[model samples]
Target: MLAWLLQRQRPVPIIQMLCGPSGEKILGQLRVNSHLREHLRTIYAAPCGVDVTWIQEYLDGLRIPLLTEAQSEELEGEVSLDDLMEALGRMVSRKAPGPDGLPVEFYRAYPTVILPQLVQCTERCNTVAKSICEEGQLTCHAAHGASAIYRHALRRLLHTRKRARLDPDGSADNVLNLK
Candidate 1:
């Protein structure tokens, strides 16, 4: 598995244009490499501690939209064989396979065998998801008034929002800065 993953992984190219800590354009190979390494370390390597007051404050300032009961039910609906077949049909062919090296063409050519297994796997996942929800390990749209049950989910959503805002083609505009 590790070999398969390593074979697929590609190294990121060095940034040719980046501003240094002094707000000047970084130049030269050695300086760029050193500055990039230091910048990444400063951003990611934090002293480990459990001060979550800022996280609570951040989450408290945002409003997560509530889903209607009907919408929630639709999202939780069972996956039908026909639905799976349609989705598979829409998939592009000749793509690289996963670690198992079983391609979409293989599944398309052997639907009778693949469809049933796919349905079974999906059902198993749904069962595990429901179990997690029941055990209070995860919270869904159905658990609206719950206390901190879905804080991690909210945090992820917030991170996604921040990324979208900071994306090159996107405008931060009215979006509050999140860190």
Candidate 2:
């Protein structure tokens, strides 16, 4: 089982792409890659609905209290090999592998072998985060901003807003409490 899992899997092919904003289709590897890159650059450069000044004010208004040295040490100590194992055990096995292409199934099946490595990797990440935090950099917060719960809540809110907007009686604003 270990040997079979260790063997490399074939890469999934890029099968198709939309060539234009209006959904004109393009097929093939080279053209698809080039067109997709151009499309993504254009999309990424477009302004989102969020107001930068409002966001800046909101962040500036936040008054999160700093943790004491002991509290910081305690928080760091809370992450352990056992905690990593527990989290790994909770991961769904059938999800697609990341860029490394080693699936969750491999870790689930070989916890004893992988736990130490995972713990080390996590420790390194924690160290990097701590350094970034100490420097008063925004990178750490930005990188870890989206929790799973937050993502789910955002999705649910969007879905409810969409449903409300589709109602016939103009009650969507009332439902969402929109001005």
Q: Pick the candidate with the highest lDDT.
A: 1
- RMSD values, in order shown: 13.5, 13.9
Q: Mind giving the per-residue lDDT tens digits that candidate 1 earns over 138-159?
A: 6853343232222222222223
Against the true structure, what is each candidate's TM-score? 0.45, 0.37
TM-score of structure candidate 2: 0.37
Q: List the residue pairs that clash in candidate 2.
A: none
Candidate 2, run of 10 with poorest lDDT: 148-157
77-124, model 2: which lDDT tens digit per residue?
424566656556556678743456778888788888877875576556
What stretches of model 2 exceed 4 Å from their correct place?
Answer: 1-29, 46-51, 78-119, 126-179
Maximum-TM-score candidate: 1
lDDT of 1: 0.58
Number of residue pairs clashing in candidate 2, backbone atoms closer than 3 angstroms, sequence gap of 3 or more or interchain: 0
- Candidate 1 Cα errors over 4 Å, as ranges: 1-50, 96-99, 131-179
